[model samples]
Target: MSNRNIQLAVLDMAGTTVADGGLVLRAFDIAATAAGIETEGPERDRARRYVLDTMGQSKIAVFRALLGDEDRAQQGNLAFEAAYDALIDEVGVTPIPGAAQAIDALRTAGVKVTLTTGFSRGTQDRLLNALGWNDIADLTLAPSQAGRGRPYPDMVLTALLRLRIDAVDQVAVLGDTTSDIGSGLAAGARIVAGTLTGAHDKDQLRAAGATHVLPSVGEFAELILASRI
Candidate 1:
């Protein structure tokens, strides 16, 4: 049983639990080029850097920042989704080692787990379908289900509400990026953990307000179950 008061675990999908093998960046290049970001140059380079920097944010939101115009942003988002889905079909997605077992352990410990992502609902579903994770968690959320995505606290808050969590203090959130940390912090979750399996480093996660940093999602169950907090 868990020693911590954490009742809900809001986990990020990609990088944190799912390993896409750099498919995100690969898909971004294809979509950006199609959306007129240029095949290669300073503009493409800057946009690519932005995508890296903003890992864990909603895809549409990222495209909005990159493309500026709403129409262009929507187009780019669609293109990104298409490209990402195609890649998934071509190469498939895999779970980070021990991720599924970790989640099962958490659930067995009486913690409600909700998988979350900045990807669109369709893409999120595709990932779940690809991994055969359709019933893996108590719930799964995408940015569309919530009003906003990471760095805004919407998805985390939505999970808390939908899961009937007593309070933000009773929640533990984990992910592999600073944006994930930021969302958890903003939602007032007591434990906001950053894992090293994805983008960003320890310093970056801490700077973004992570409460703890773990090596990967495989270690998250122990941190929560053994918690004395």
Candidate 2:
């Protein structure tokens, strides 16, 4: 098919597009510590594991899983938000290598780009604005807008709707986690997995049903270009 036939490209935020480098985890640590949960050595490891295992899940869902109860989770979430907001300035967040160029190329080729993230709208906007990406994305869909979260395909479907794309074959979902791959597969979109991002390795991504496992966003862009050719 021609490049013009591709209508949309749905991208995941955290690991797929931006390299936050454990900024979210650090926020969780601050929140957990504020909640009187000590995070030292093994405990810290466990907390990190929890974050990694649920990388693509909604922020609320991740909080609930870590805090163990809805009430506690709410409290922790508040702390996390405060800590994240405060540290966001100091936190090193850069677009993943080749991400900007790839996105530009795609847009120049008439591909609509939609970003689906598990972050709250407030947080997502903050990050985008801070990174000078406020106008770079065609549409930004958040988990808060979805009734259900990752592993459920709600956000991905929402992005598709925003893009006004009916056929899943004309869209590609690119992400770096099992949840991401699962959501894309569930939505019947072509899945391009990124390994240099999220916690998932190539085998894990493939196991989750990724159509293509690429080393980085740049490689994925090359694949997309080749497909058009």
Candidate 3:
């Protein structure tokens, strides 16, 4: 025990846990294709950049930013989920090395674990079942269930409330995107950790207010046991 006094770890899906193999971007492309949106021009490139920039944000938010309307954004979100589901069906869920083990180790330490993601409930459930992780986490939340997603602190706040953990400082929020860092910081978590295995680079994570940066989510247990993260 490193005496970190942490009680819970709020994790992100996709790049943070599941091995992000450009599948998300490809899914976005598929959705765009389904929606018959711009694909081969400066406009498409800019949208893709925005998607990367806003990783860990609500899919609806990303689509709204990219598509610029509620109806169109909702359509894009549905299409994205459909395409991502298809991808998962074809290839299956691939966990990041040590992600499941890390979660189990944290649970063994008596730390409650919750997963918070921008992915909707259906998609989240699909991934969880594929990983056989449906029973691993103490809580599973999606933006559609929570008020908002990452970079807003809503997900973290919801977890704290639902878990009945009064002290924000007793929690660790870990992910691989700036939105994750921002949300953790906003929620006043003691450890806002960013892993390099995902979307944002170290500099971007730092710029977004990550208190600690690790090589991957796998190192979280070690870092925490060392009183680092």
Candidate 4:
């Protein structure tokens, strides 16, 4: 039996379990251009850097920070979703190698998994449908489904409540971004692991409060199972 007593697992979507192949930047370029940011200038360059820096945050929140106008942010978010969906049709998306097996392992061990994303619910559903993952998770949450997105702890806490998990400490969180680490830490999860299959690096994940750094989500089931010994 696992001694960690983790009854719930909260995982990030894009860049963590889902490999989107840098489509985020491509979509962002399209959205930013539509939002009046020039294609090749310093302004667009700075915005792109910001996008990379805040990879796991809510898309609308990121756009709000970048554009600074609620209206423009809304427009940019819509444009981003449209472009990303189009790209998904063009290129498709895939799961990180072994991520499905890892998730299945965790669930078979009695851990209820909830997939969370910073994207809007519309985009999240589209991604899930594309990957045929609509039924994979015990629950899936977007910022709209919860109160807020990562770096805020709302989604994790919401999962705790929705899943009827008894305590926050019985939860395990995993992601590839600092924002994911921050959300897990803020929610007081017992195991806040950062995987290398996504945005941030080891140092950044540790700095953001990851309890453990993993090579990939493929190792997550082992980490949880090994806690028994």
Winning model by lDDT: 1
Residue 123, candidate 1: alpha-carbon lDDT: 97
The residue-by-residue lDDT of candidate 1 on 98-151, one tens digit each, is: 999999999999899999999999999999999999999999999999999999
Any runs in candidate 3 off by more than 4 Å, and if so which?
A: 1-4
Between 3 and 4, whose TM-score is larger? 4
lDDT of 2 by residue, 96-120 (tens): 8888888888888777888877777
C-alpha RMSD of each candidate structure in angstroms: 2.1, 2.4, 2.4, 1.8
Q: After best superposition, candidate 4 residue 118: deviation in angstroms?
A: 0.6
Model 3 accuracy (lDDT, Cα): 0.87
| Colliding pairs, model 2 | none
TM-score of each: 0.97, 0.90, 0.95, 0.96
Return the clash pairs for model 4, or none: none
Deviation (Å) of 88 in candidate 3: 0.4
lDDT of 3 by residue, 1-229 (tens): 2345888799999889888788789899988876667779987788889999999999888998887888888899999999989998897779889998999988887788999888889999999998899998999999977798878988888888899885888889999999999999999999999999889899999999888999887888766656634
Off by over 4 Å in 4: 1-4
The C-alpha lDDT values of all candidates are 0.92, 0.78, 0.87, 0.91
On lDDT, who's better, 2 or 3?
A: 3
- Model 3 earns a TM-score of 0.95
